[model samples]
Target: MADLGAGTGLFTRLLLSAGAARVDAIEPNPEMRAELEAALAAQVAAGAVRVHAGTSEATGRPDASADLVTAAQAAHWFAPEPTVRELRRVLRPGGRVLLVWNDWRGVDAPLNRAYGEVVAGFTEADVPPLATRVPEAELPGLLPGGFEKRLFDHAVPFTRERLRALAGSVSYLPSPGDPAYAAMTAALDRAFGEPAGGEAPLVYRTHAYLGRLDG
Candidate 1:
């Protein structure tokens, strides 16, 4: 198995927990790869998980090295054709791929709408999801054999603090000490006043695309 854009090894950790014999965790950023290596030091030392410095389009693994390739919340940034070629190179015959993203498009929930407005102010454009902007991905593309999409209705509860963390986790969102960070957070505070439970639901759905990489 190869996990692209492994980041801090969030999904990589899940793969280990699910009994995958081995996983080649590929992440381009040195900082993130370091964090993953540190967090999974035992697995790395045991040779169960290997962290590599690479990207979706240029994984350092050998041809047919992976039985499965997965990208979670990270494929939007990938350049389609190169990434497709790389996936074909690294996957064994009939090996599978999974691409997942959280969908918030067209959502009109009060909290979601309010949050989108806040984000839009910082981005200086429409608040439509970046996932939706990717070509043939949110629906279908690279998978010439076609793919299966499974949607899971989900929601995350967020208070101001949790919301700040969530925003920070996203690569594009303003982070602490950024010029826009304080303003974005202040706007969020206004959009979501203190709730009874200190959190409110941000409704969204998870989209999982599963396909065999025969093509």
Candidate 2:
């Protein structure tokens, strides 16, 4: 199994826990790959994980060798056509491609709104439209092949620490030494201080689209 864009190995850990005998994690960003490697050290030592420093466009895996190809939140950074084409190339006959994302519910509740505001502050208005944008409504056209779409609503335990970690995982957030980073941290602190239920879990609506390679 291949975990494309396996930054920090979140889903890579999941894949290991879910009966995958081997996991090949492909990551492009050097810093992210470093983090992933650090996180997967135990698994790597046990020979359960392999880290490939690459991206989905060029996974460097042999043709038709993978049983399953999965892209978690990283699919939003890829070129749809070439990515799907390459995914097809690496998948063996009857192999499957799975695209999954954990969409945070940010607009519904008070605490969620506050959290969303903190995130919105980091958005760069001038940044160009990204090459890979996963719009739920546009999934069908992106693949050009038969696919199955499924939605799974799940809650992940949320703490101020976890929230801060999530924020750190995003690319748009101000860098550690940047002036804006202090302000963002201040905002998050203020937002978390308000009276709220303790250890309340945040709901993440996961969208997964799976397709069989047309071999």
Candidate 3:
């Protein structure tokens, strides 16, 4: 299995836990790969996993080397044409590519609304979310032979600090050293204001697409 754009190996860990015998976790960011390697040290030592610095457009993996390829919440940044071709070249004849997204766009709740408003306000207004700039569903259309999609309700337990951490993790949001970072944290802190039992739901819908590209 090949895990592309495997940020901090979150999905890669899931794949391993789900019994994917062997996995090549491909991440482009050195920092994230470092964290992934540290977290999966035992797995690496046992040959259960290997971490590589690579991108979705150029994985540097041998042709048709994977039985399964997955990208979670990372494809939005990929150049679609190269990404499609790369996935095709990386997978074996019967291999499948799975794209997963945990989206919060349309959740109808007060806390979620406040959180969204803050993020939108905090980011560069001129630079829109890639999902808004282009319909994300179009990736499925880009698949040579279409794909199957499934949507499930997904939620995360949230607290003020966790909310701040989650916001910081987003690629577009201000990082810790940015001028707006503290302000963004403050806004998130207010949005997450005093939940019963000190927590609330970070609601989302998990959208998954699975299909084989034409051999």
The TM-score obtained by model 2 is 0.79
Candidate 1, residue 107: lDDT: 70
Stretches > 4 Å off in candidate 3: 129-134, 178-183, 195-197
Q: Provide the global lDDT of candidate 1 against the true structure.
A: 0.81
CA-lDDT, candidates in order? 0.81, 0.78, 0.83
TM-score of every candidate relative to the true structure: 0.85, 0.79, 0.86
Report each candidate's C-alpha RMSD, comma-separated, in the order given.
2.7, 3.4, 2.6
lDDT by residue (3-30, candidate 1, tens digit) is 9999999999989999999999999999
lDDT of 3 by residue, 95-177 (tens): 89888888877788666898999999877766656543225557654466667888887777888878888889876789998
Give the clashing pairs for model 1: none
- Candidate 2 stretches greater than 4 Å from native: 31-47, 126-133, 195-198, 213-215
TM-score ranking of the models: 3, 1, 2
- Full-model lDDT, candidate 3: 0.83
**lDDT tens digits by residue: candidate 2, 69-185:** 998988877777778778888888888888888777533655577777887778677643332347766665445566788988777777776677777766777766767877887
